[model samples]
Target: MDEIIDFESLKLHTAAGYIRASNRCFTCKAKRQHCDYKYPVCSNCAKNNTDCMAWAKGSKSPIPRSIACYLEKRVAQLELEAHRLRTELNPEHLDDKENIAANLSSKPFSGVCNSEKDDIGDESFGFLYFRSSNLPAPFDCTLHSSDRGNIRTFMARNPMVDIYSIPSKIADIILQNYLDIHLPQYPIVSSEYVRELKSSVFEKRNTCGPYEKAVMGIILAMSTATLSYKGEKGALASSGALFSYFLSQILQVEWSDKLKKLQILLLVAHYAFSNPYAADSCYAMKEALRISVEMGLHKELDFDHISPLIMQTRRRLFMVCMNMARHVFSVNKRMFPIPSELISFQLPEAVDDHYITDSGIDLSGPPTKAAAIHFYRFRLYETEIYDVLWGHKSIKCGLKEWVQKMSNNLDSWLSEANHFSTINQLKYRAICHASGHVRLYSRSPRKQWRNREDALLLMESVIKCLDEYLVNASTGWLAYLMAGVFHVEELTVCLLDIMWNESNWIFDHYSQAYISTQVIQCIGLLQQFSLRWPDIEKSKMVSYLSNLHLKITSQLEHGFVIDPHIISQLNFLIFPQVSTGYGLDSLPEDTVDLDHNFIQMQQWNDNFTSSLSIL
Candidate 1:
């Protein structure tokens, strides 16, 4: 027993005159060997000249605390490296889409999922884009079987929708509304064709196709809902009430023709732009996007075998789908999925639907509804601008030279036929003109602006759009609906930056004079548009524009330079909200047009600016 005890004591002796350490290197832990109790560098690591890092796994709490902590940190490092490798390996990532070595200047249109995101100590989670474009589900087979647990599609139905067989007198009102309001905005469906068809359909309600009835009901509902002004009940509720009746008729219809179904959905989505009333509008817009893509509307396809009328309708409908989808995603603040480059479809011929037949198209007649031809052309050009800006994968799009070139391209298109010889011609031309300038105005706030003269032109263009709306109140509402009012607020904020914040491109006395005059005219024009379209008064966009126009113009009038801190305060007024839009689209008749809350804030800015010395 004494000999055994002495042998155990000799075997348990501490190495190198050190007590047993509570920690061990990963190599010793793995090899099942004892580690030297040493600091800075363990005796085993020093002797072998190896790393003293720890990487161990244990379910029991008997493992050394140092090894456990080191393993925890090592696991985190491995996770970070894994994430980086995943990001680098992801070909669909916007950064690596072009080539392995290529560097893109434009940020990924938005953020990415955890695997692709840059690591910042763990927390990364978001949407993942797995396709090059908005292709159909049939084309995108990358999703795992387990990932696609279920599918939820929005479908509206109402059996009682047949009750809205509008009387002839009401039919007359609805038809005129289509001609005056709907035609200018869409112009895809022919007014004469629809008018004659509605009469025939109403007469033969028992015999006509469900698609025809559905089409007629949707158009009439959209027109009437647009023309009707609900005072305090909110435009959304009023439009929702109006749409509930028509939608029931729509959903109950047996839709066999896929193209017809797409057209009806586009119509509903278009109405949502003017009055985003219900969820169906948003769903209809999304479905339209999907159907148009699957049907190959965005891609060039051989359609010579199709009928002439059907061909033209396809072209017009696809254009409406592109523009309408953009507005939907933009307002909802979702990253738009449909890439601009995928659009290769040709514009429809400039002629009436009556002139087209099963054999071919003829543009010889005096067609009154050719406004859509021009609108489609504009949308095509807009797509070109988007693509051209993003054409060079390595370049930034906010450059002034590129913007000026694009703006010139638009002007050249409008310069082809500027004469407002007809109401249809005038309405579309003004819309295209204002839309082009607004596009320029949108780019003004990025980095360094182009020039004050260009800024002045953009401001005049906005005012000019409002002027047209006022001049042709009957159909001028088309211009009001085309571009909307969000950009106006954003552009005014740019104007404030140029006039005071930057202090570099300071407007000359003459420039200041015209800017102030145009600024006031812009507000005045909006106030006038407010009388007809209450959204002009109800939007925080217009409120910010009005108040900023007041404050910024005063600084110009009184010759005051803005302070940095004050500029920040004014800029904070917009923030994340301006990107989506402002307040309610429509307001009560008794609702005060002015933003009284903003007025008090502007008064505060006025006082602060008042104390500053003149330049």
Candidate 2:
């Protein structure tokens, strides 16, 4: 027993020494080991600027409390520094490239503005691309199983949607991808997806059957509703009312009604996604409202059973009508002169269902409620696309003619000399001119005339009116960008026409010619607006011009080479006027007349005609 106790005491002493030795800095701890001695640190630690704490024979270094704490604090600081460096390197911070890189070698906080956003985490999660020009198969395949769980799982893995974020030019690619990739095996969308869409409508309702029933009614209505039909007349009144209800909900901004309608439409789309006109419910709803409005059905529609899909359909239709009205106003303002005394028409009872409040409220009072109805009416007008460059040429022409006739004697009607004039009266002159020009331009070239000076005056007036209107009216009232783009186009086209025709004649007249050339250059900047918005039809026109340009250059180089003698004679006829002012002898006195222009114009016209004949 005494011998065992002595052995235990010796083992305890050896353990205590081992722990003490392990707890020292490298130089102190490796006293027995072969760590090279150096001043202030071990040779390895001196080179590294750190205490060597790596594992040694038989054990990891038992770091000293003071030294361990100091090292821990330093490690934390270094980790923070490294994190900042990595952040600077990350592509997510590209928006702050100039600042991030400048401070990269410097301290994180130095020279960096506190207000700067250093990090912008990804919000879009993911997206796919399909270029507009690419010819690819459509990806329209679905998951093989119709089970709700399986379909939801598949969508979670790879959600399908229209590429609305991309340019519409590339929308075709997305559509094609959908057709090719997902449509084959997974043809039918599960009913569960359709049911999921039900949430977009009718949230507070106690029951939701009327909502679905209303949706079905709208689908049947869209397929069968007609203007002459009335419910009592046995002409599918349910469908017409459904159509009317949808339009009213949209125009009135009835969100509850819209959601209900949306669910029905989604179900329709789900069932008939492959149908060409499956998604046309909105279009039909739009048509219904437009026709109703045209017929002046102010209060003759019902909306109690409006569905969500029908509501969307009506909204789209309302937008289309507004767009049409805008096109009319923009292309030819005279056709839709902001009316002075707009006739107040009573809408039929069917059209009177208010989506904004309890349907029980009576609105049969005087024109006091006129302001309320008028507010929604203006929305119909506001959706007018101001920058669209392509549409019905014939309609635009007709509109131009209408404006011309309406504003024929504007001086008599709009003269400031009238003592009877009010503030609005004085404003009508500018309004009339602006609206007239917009309407005129919306039409065909048949209405196009050579009155560049008059058009310029109208365009200038428009700019002035727009400026003043911005100051006086509410911010949301004026379409500043639209007005600017339109004014730019108007001013530019006038200048371009002048420059194109008068370049050769006035090119040498430095003062006048310089002005003309400068105008042409200015027009180039305005033309850039064409690229800011998307319009397939207008884009096609631009593409056509580009192609034609190449074709013309090719032809000019290889074909239709001019005779040297003709060129010389032409120079003699035209160059003298430019160089020595001698060609003034050849120009006719009646140069301002059409006859003079005809002779010069014939050259280009003949070229075009010849080209067409050859083709």
Candidate 3:
């Protein structure tokens, strides 16, 4: 080497010097300051140990490079001493012995680098360390060392597994923890923030199929609406508006056409009763023919699988639609009249012809089929004609005259409903219409009626039909709607007066034996209203209240033995009164209040049941 670079000098000048340790034990020789040790090994042993060993071995050992110069000087000195001794003793053998020693003392060859092997081992140890990955990142994210350390420990212990391998134990813990924390804060996962969380998780997992995701998104949106609408009126309207926003988002992001169409139809059907405005979605929903054509889609959405609770919700939703439409129709009919020629006959003749046949009219007669041609036709056309006739005097007069003449001829068909069987059909259809009307009608008061007289007539006919239809009726949803209609007026009064009033005698004999959970809840709430009724009304209205008290007492006593109806339940516990719990942070603090009414309600019911038991 031009400069004869030393290992010591190189170590001192290197960039790695900052990280170097100068620890010397029994091997490489360096000075006190250079050696990283509490007690330094002396320079003789550290620097020349290899050469000293080689010299001591004479002809048997080879010199090491680290001390080669020092070893060579020593070897020369020894050879001189040997030559002098040989001259004193036997000079002849000296040359041969010295040559033999020179031949034996050759330098040993060394491998490239012994230290590199140790570096590789250390690197492998670091690469395998768990803390180097998940733990270190989280730790570095935090400013405080202690905080970082704690979080690092947590993450190290709870590494995220692949979504497919989500253990039941982990899932349970996560669900409980999530519910315990977020249920109160979020209340509804459909909120923008929570949905973002769901979306983020979904993306990261990459586990959900496109169709599944689309279905899941729709389910999430609908569930949010359903939960929110529980205690509110105009539930469909409120839900429909929210769903439209969900639809807007889904339409843009979700590309699976089949799922997209099915989801749209569901949204439409879901809101159909509540928001006729949702009918505007028909522009998109006509694609339902293509979207939901698969048999699997029907299986996934079977009416048979619909729960009692959902059935009730749907029936109520339908009732709202029908009632709203019927009320609107009644109003339009009262306001105006259109000419007979202008009315469209949309009902099929077979269906139209049945009404006339039932009305005891022959289709052969020129006068008209009394049921189909006169009453049914009149009923359908009257509203539209009246709408047209509102501004025109001549049309109004002519419409009025026509309506009167039509009414006279229609008496026979209209009166046909006076028959028991016919009355039942009319009542059934009217209730169905009432249910549907509740969805479409606007809230503005324009002399609207609940059609109390017609409702009372329907209720009377239902009671008459009950014994015959009881078993069959429970299977269908119509009875639930009928129950809802009967209870709506009572519900209004109970809310206004803050007390329950006894329903008429028909309810007493109706029996809870065939009652569905929806019916039971309606009864339970009404019963609760009676117990919580105003104290002022209690003493003064004792005679009026007697029936309610007796009815409740008798039912509670006999409910197990006679009716055994399972009451529809509300999960009040999930939505609690506590602050700093799930979903509560998002709720206004002032809105939290204690419910003491139910305690008294339960007490009263228990007392009444006990007294009845004694009797």
Pairs with backbone N, CA or C atoms under 3 Å apart (clashes), candidate 1: none
Query: Candidate 1, residues 1-615: lDDT per residue as tens digits?
Result: 112113333233222221222455666766777877454357787789875643323321122223322322343345345444433444466543222211111122111111122221221210111001110111112222111111111112112334245567867876786776567557646656787777667776677665576567666656655553333223323344445555445545654455666776677556544443222244456456645654556655567667777777777677677766654443322334544444677766656666777788788964444555555556655654433432322335556676677777778768754643445344457555675665555332343344566656755676566565545444333333323433334334444555555344546433766655655655555455444343333344455456655766676567777555446535443233233233222322222211122122222223212211010
Q: Tens digit of lDDT per residue, candidate 3, span 1-615? A: 122324554344333332222333323232223333322233455555432221111122222222322222333345345434422323465334223222111211011011111110000000011111111111111121111111123233323223324354533444343333222211212122334445454555465443434333333333333332233223323333343343333434433243334433444433322222222122122223212222122112234665533332222222222222222333222221112232222221221121233224244532111222222433343343333332222443563354344334334444553342332223333332332222112111221222333234433433333322333233322222212322232222221111111123324533433222223433443333223122112222222223333444465545423321211001111111112122311222222101112112222233222211110
User: Candidates' TM-scores?
Assistant: 0.54, 0.27, 0.21
In angstroms, the error of model 2 at 447 is: 5.1
Q: Please give the lDDT score for candidate 2.
A: 0.30
lDDT of each: 0.47, 0.30, 0.28
Give candidate 1's error at residue 365 in angstroms: 4.5
Question: In model 1, what is the error at residue 498, expressed in angstroms?
Answer: 3.7
Model 3 poorest 10 in a row by lDDT: 119-128
Rank by TM-score, highest first.
1, 2, 3
Name the candidate that leads on TM-score: 1
